[model samples]
Target: MACMEFTPEHRGTVRLEAREYGRSVLGAPLLYYPCRSACRLLVFAAIHGEEPETTFLLSRCLRAFDTNFEHVAFVLCANPDGATLGTRGNANGVDLNRNFATSNWNPAHVQSRSILESARDTLLSPGKAPGSEPETQALVALIESLKPESVIAMHSPIGCIDAPARTPLVERLQGTLNLPWKPDIGYPTPGSFGTWCSEHRVECITLELPRLAPELLFERYGESFARFLAAQD
Candidate 1:
């Protein structure tokens, strides 16, 4: 197929062929852009609604492409309800990050700081049970189906890349984003996708974008990010 033209003028109009992986609690469509070829990487963003910038930046980078990825799949907004509601959690007030069915999956409420400088004032349910939410279940199913070698779970305003080990992929991301890499996020993430990936033996890299304005992030990383994905193809 001819690659779709994706100039800035076509940004709003250009659309990728997205498949419905599942639905949210409010019946919002859980969408994902499947790779056109073998899937090597599964990159997801905006699992937390409050960090819409992750979605925005990924969307912008995607808009630069005219065709499906040759080896990379994408989930621009993993938590549509939360993104729409401008909350960190989904419609059920569950932190989707903490809802994964991992060995450390905790039923206890997850505490998150509202602002970087603020205390952990916000509390959210992990879920009725691990992988209980439809979104979480669907994502797990998708990962199983795709069998990607690695996954990039995008988050924001933390200004660092979080991974268990400094794999080649992590090193490339560190160079691409020009951000420091951390062994962990400096806190316990009981049921995080990273933890789930570890148990499943799939590599997961949490790409925590810096605390930059949306436009600035795009301005600095947009083209470079597009080129990075293209390199994977």
Candidate 2:
């Protein structure tokens, strides 16, 4: 379910922007937390679109915002159509996560991304050029405008904080979720959200959890996640 699935009576803020993804029908739907303290953060989930699990967690967390940060924000469902179709890429086959303009990253353009190709396919098959997809462009616009202190990108199964270059905050996040101390061995992704955050010197934490039912996940990680966000300063 996208941010629009919530009603005005629901809570928080869901504002529609007139922004379009280039000349396509794709538009970035932004869900913001404008209420109120210290540092602000952006929570990005499901850049893959098929990982509705991340979206489910984010939807629950966004409504339960009581953290050290002055504010928290999310893209909600970055790839709406792909999400609706239960696929990994936008309708036009661009991976919004891999489509970002990065100086060191150049994903080879591949078409029609699914579970097999997913984010890599979009980079391998960048249509005309980088940031070509409406989804990619819209994401760029949103992130540039918000300029949050850090971005925690929610993903699945890895359960490690990937610092493309280096960051103490994200490194600490790995420690926060640890059952035992481990090294930050997350591999490098050239055109990924982690890379983007590393480039900007912002904390970009990629949360990896099991692909379980939302109810079960909440029961397991809700308290831990709250503690994680609270330790963000």
Candidate 3:
């Protein structure tokens, strides 16, 4: 069943032992909550340090439960250094999401906007080489080891469910979140995790939460989202 009725005490009380997969540029441990049984899904948040909302919302959802889910592992924060520094990229100024060792990974600097409406005014490196960053390499290794049936990569502000294929999982997420499902985010993402998943034949779903404040987001979706996971199990 879904977690006991979520209460104020449960908001920050749910605990799970984290296994270290790797360390970040700042020596922060890359931690993941491993599932107790065979892993079928891996949910990760905060690949972009600037998007702490993703990490916050995922944490709130995970905290609703006291123990690990049987089929889902969790990465609460993929780029601790970036989150700490409040930069989109890691300490090395490389966007970790674009540092995956995929065929299309490139060394060219990437352009991102300051805000949703702003121009693409910021430039960041993809990395010295594909999988150059420790966080990227470690996450890749962990995913290969777990070999989950699907991965849910959390991001924010675009407010859509993005998957290359309109599979049932994506459809479910779209329906649950009341968001549109798109074939793409309408831009080229050369070295994204989604692209890497495609190369490895793994199903990936990008959940871009709406543009809402972290607490407000939790207030709106916390209970329903928790039940969604419980139903999955």
lDDT of each: 0.89, 0.57, 0.89
Candidate 2 steric clashes: 11
Candidate 2: list runs displaced more than 4 Å.
1-28, 34-39, 65-69, 110-124, 164-168, 179-188, 230-233
Q: List the residue pairs that clash in candidate 3.
A: none
Off by over 4 Å in 1: 1-6
Query: Whose lDDT is greatest here?
Result: 1
CA lDDT, candidate 3, residue 47: 95
Q: For candidate 1, lDDT tens digit of each residue in 1-233?
A: 22434476757743668999999999999999998877899999999999999999889888866668778999999999999999999999999999999989988999999899999999999999989998899999999999999999999898999999999999988888799999999889999999999999999999988899999999988877777777766
Q: Residue 152's C-alpha lDDT in candidate 3?
A: 92
Which tens-of-lDDT digit does each residue in 1-233 have in candidate 3?
Answer: 33545778777655866899999999999999988888888999999999999988888888878888888889999999999999999999999889998999988999998999999999999999889999999999999999999999999899989998889888777767788888999998989999999999999999998999999988887767777767666
**Higher TM-score: candidate 2 or 3?**
3
Model 2 scores worst on lDDT over the 10 consecutive residues at 14-23
Stretches off by above 4 angstroms in model 3 are 1-4
My TM-score estimates for the predictions, one after another, are 0.96, 0.70, 0.97
